[model samples]
Target: MKKIFTLIATALMTVGANAQDAKFQIYTEVEPNTYAVTTNLDAVKAEFGEEKVTEAWGMGVWLPVDYVLIDNANLKATTAVDLTPIYFSGNKFTDMQKEFPAYTGYMNLGSSLGQNNWKGTEVIEDLTALKAAYHGAVSVFPKVDGTLSFGVYAGDNSRSIGIFNMATEDEMNEEIFMGAWANYYNFRHDGVEAAPDGTIPAKGSAAYVSAEVKAGRQYILVGGANKNLTMHQIKFVPAQGTGINNAGVSSEKTIEAVYTLGGIRTNGIGKGVNIVKYSDGTTVKIVK
Candidate 1:
């Protein structure tokens, strides 16, 4: 009996090894001017043998593995790239001017249809670089500076307010990125492994969405606009539900009390002008 069990285990192990070795198979024609292999036999080449395989992350996250595999092997693989337009007109422009009721020139948000689009992969490390890139792509206003809100268009009608404030602003930061807005979410390959969360219909031949990172250039969509769309400030205290949200809350939070300005309290006396206490033991106050 022991001998029979050993034999069965060895057979299973061999089968598993073969399956792993032959992961994914294909048979296709090599195309002209298409790069499927590289000339270098020395260096590691998961990227490319011809030109470098630039991985364009449309949603800024998620892997493009299937796309990379096909592009890597196909003889006539042409890269699919999309340029995202950055619009300059503020929807609230007319209101702001009305509030001031004086600065007559700030009324209209001049060029509306378009400002210009970037390839989404543009290296915009900060506001300065972002402004410079937008201008470099195409300059409409004399200066793409503050007082101007920014929005990005993803073809069709989908859009996201890229910037609310250029000065000390930092949109697309780490905090609300992965959860709130999965910007440019796309598949790594044309036919990547099926995902649990992918939009698979009953027929199993439908579109999908995933949040993994791989290689190659593919397009994904951001679900909704990022909150407030304001970037990071230079030196301001962090605001609630804005700064980096690292963990999830398991329980409900209850507010303890709210104090009237300059009013005395018996339970917990605060020395400031106004004070607020919460079940989480958090105190918000304005100190003179």
Candidate 2:
């Protein structure tokens, strides 16, 4: 019985070894630019029949393996190489100005696109060189009366870097002063008031119409005109239903409250009363 068991085990091991050494029959094509062989299973099936081809798998299409049946066979192989060169294209400021005339003046001045000056004068030969010469910078601006106000300047020449200031007087030297002023005016006018209870009341509430509140700070214009009024900050409370108590309580109880730092009396008024109050408790009213 021991002899019989030994014979059975030896037979199984021999079978496993034969299976491991079995070579898959495959048809190969030599690559034109490499010392590699590509197997075409479908072609092999058509030429040698499906039964003879058995199973087929691709080694690699570009650079396959070099098969050597004999140990003394001399076979050499090479890998794919990239020889492409990287090139850098500078900011096309001239093209931008010519193509978009309205924006051309600013683009040419180098105040609206990218950095004003590049460290290198030669065209960037690679990504590494371009990154070293040109990079972005981040700047922070404190809010005017707790309101964020920031500007960006981009240029290709030395004069491209425009002067920046926290105050309007400092911006006088800027060539685009008028444009900046207009932008600031638009931002100020678009502001909405906050409720006395420190919340943004409804659109028709006093808080919504009086002053614009953001974060924990409030803003109000002192003068009627943009140039006259310096932005001021104040604390605010949220005025909701029954939150505000003033004249005509029964008739205006539903309105919200928005208190300002200064009086509405000014040299030049724009449209409505600069000082706004919620006459109706549920609504906001602009009053001088």
Candidate 3:
């Protein structure tokens, strides 16, 4: 009996230890013009081979531009192989243009906007146009040596354009600053909250309320409507380390305000007040 009890306790302790050691992993898909680095130098060097790894700005990592080019080349080759069927089909230049916008756009430019016709007329024209556009828009910033480079280009008017360095795994784990950019949004650090459907609510409205987060949770201040059919200010002090408390005094205060202003109809002492119902199955309510 004593041995069995000891064995069970040991197994429980090991399970607890394993649970504590497990960390959350967040993965994001790589986007165009973006580069990522591993935190472990030895691991990175091993995967990339020592020759491909280099030191940039005192930090050792793989070459950013070269890495992007290599991946891009592989993608292009795969696409070309898959497109072999189109060559055999009775597809004309116009049909190809209709099928591939990017290819068509390039062809339009290569023909000098319909100026000169060349052999393999359509393909050459499209490629030439694409090359001109690529050269006009894309600029490469090479590091001191010829080993690494970063690409830059002008984005849409609403979006900001620039090169951004990424943080290595070690830097993220240690919270060390790795790189800087003019336009960066830290959604984790920012006080913005999303609705149940993951849509950001409008600012200054109950749908999208800003709150002070503490202990990995958010607290929002909900206000009640006033007598003049407008929303009145109500203090909502949320409980620490949890979301808004629907049954707290702060929620009651909002209910009272809304009832006084005729925004909500209530019955009985313990009944809740209905604020609004959304199509996404979320209900905003206040309770006593």
Winner by TM-score: 1
Query: How does each model score on TM-score?
Result: 0.21, 0.13, 0.16
Residue-level lDDT tens digits of model 2 in 29-106: 111111111123343344335654332122111111122110101111111011111111123323333322222111
User: Candidate 1 versus the native: TM-score?
Assistant: 0.21
What stretches of model 3 exceed 4 Å from their correct place? 1-68, 71-158, 182-288
Q: How many clashes in each structure? A: 25, 24, 5
Q: Tell me which of candidates 1 and 3 scores higher on TM-score.
A: 1
Clashes of 3: 5
Candidate 2: what lDDT? 0.20
Tens digit per residue, CA lDDT, model 3, 1-288: 011000100000011221221111100012222221112344334434565444321122322211121111101000100000101111122333343222211101011222111111121111112222111111122211111212111111111112123233454456564323212111111135545552332222221122221231111111111100011111122334333333322221332222211233334223332232223322222222
**What's every prediction's RMSD, in angstroms?**
26.9, 37.2, 28.6
| Positional deviation of residue 244's Cα in model 1 after best superposition, in angstroms | 14
Give the alpha-carbon lDDT of every model.
Answer: 0.21, 0.20, 0.20
Candidates 1 and 2 compared by lDDT, better number: 1
Model 2, position 62, has a per-residue lDDT of: 16
Candidate of highest lDDT: 1
Task: List the candidates ranked by TM-score, beginning with the highest.
Answer: 1, 3, 2
